[model samples]
Target: MERLITYKLPKFGFPRLLAIIGCWAYLALPSQADISLTFGTYAADKPTETVRKYRPFLSFLEIELSKALGEAVSIKMVIAKEYEHSIDQLANGEVDFSRFGPASYVLATKKNPDVEIIAMESQKGQKRFKGVIAVHEESEINDLSELAGHSFAFGDELSTIGRYLSQALLLSAGISGADLQTYEFLGRHDRVGTAVGSERFTAGALKESTFKKLVKSGVPIRELTTFDNVTKPWLASSTLAPHVVEAMRHIMLEEANASAVKQIAKHGFLEGDDADYQLVRDAMEDSQSF
Candidate 1:
């Protein structure tokens, strides 16, 4: 009879076998299994309040995105201490997406050209919003010129309305930073409003929406001047998969998501691009305070 030979494969330890199987299983899984989107925003109010306001909307977003993607899409919010920090997180891919003030978006684009504006906030069906310089209703300050030789508060140093645009307004009124008696950054629009209303600040700069909300809530502040309108943008890192970005854009534009969008923006959202915020970038370049 012809000679026959048999070969035996080496046996692996149980733990080793499990580890090898786990590696292969992980590698074999769909890319979505490893995907999670982190959204970042500069603190527009108290950090906890800001997170509270956006968490429900983010949950809604997660559900919608999961349905669209046919996978368990995870979403989380990161609250940055300031606008520049938010931009930094977006630029370095620490956050996959972000909501930005017009000026912050400009700064982020400068830091990372791959950052893209995917959508913009809208109010009362309008795509633009303005900033305001306000003082206690009883303060003697009447115009930007009157702010000279008086203490002033700005919401955040990198704020579009609270700094750059408001500075432009002051410059137009022929008052430069050197012209002010003293100025300080109060960090948030609510803080600026509260400080000005309490007469702690001679005047303050903040977004018009915050000013209106504060006034409606009996803050006793009045707008001294308003800045030119600027477009706020929702930005995404280019590192995100194209399909993921597209899904976000589509969901934001959907009529069904309007209410959810309103929790963050009074109006909703509109499709937008980098060009929409070029004016903000130009303004920053033109401002000395920036």
Candidate 2:
């Protein structure tokens, strides 16, 4: 019987037999699934510039997640065309995760309370940052109170610093939308800066980073007021697996220190709390009347 079976089996050399056994072993082992995630955000800048600024961070995150999980990982970036659309996408579970500004974060939670904050962006371990109301360098509008009856520029309507917080500041100074002779939501920080710089608008509100960038690029804009604002928060969808959210949170807090992407949050991330956004909520409430 043994002799008959040997004859029936194809002749195999020692190396070939070992190779067959190895193949069988590999086949028998269970496969580890690849981790694929989609990251979402709004293009507060130009779409191409937003992609350029975010691609490196996504690549870095994928490499780190792969190493930490012992499996291949990939993160795809989805940039929304507008701020409100980005909020809608997150609330509707169109993406796995997102990085939302404070105002948009508040709005997203309102739309879907299940949205989870994974981490908040930090600046050198600090969780607070600055927003600026900018005016053309030669403009006589030296104060927020001077904005009355002058054309004002704003970024996306949902922008934290550019709209909500800036509006709060203007309200504090006794100015309202009707107080301005003209105002427009230009849809981007760069546009707001350029509008003010080109003398199209008398003053504009934008994040401090964008204000500095425009000034450095010779846009001839200067800060009229600088106000404190909460940093951005990274959020995960409620529909995402809990394990994946935990793993992503861990990776962001642990692996982001090695990230060299200076265009975004350079210092890494910190644990976030809903209470951290109370100021934005307050500002939003105050802005409703404006």
What lDDT score belongs to each candidate, Candidate 1 first? 0.83, 0.88
lDDT of 1 by residue, 1-290 (tens): 99899888579999998999999998898766435889999887889988888898888889888899988888878898878788899988899998888888888877898997778887667767778889999987777788788888987888888787777777878888799888898889999999999999899898887899999999999989887766678889868888988898898888887778787777888889777777777667667752
Per-model TM-score, in order, reads 0.86, 0.86
List candidate 1 stretches off by more than 4 Å. Answer: 1-34
Q: Candidate 2, 134: how far from true, in Å?
A: 0.6
Off by more than 4 A, model 2:
1-33, 259-263
Q: If candidate 1 were superposed on the true structure by all CA atoms, what would the RMSD be?
A: 6.0
lDDT of 2 by residue, 1-290 (tens): 45544447789999999999999999999875488788999989889998888898888778867877778988888999998899988999998899989999999999999999998998888889999898999987777887889999989888998899998889999999999999999999999999999999999889888888899999999989899999899999878889778877887777645455344678878899999999999999999888
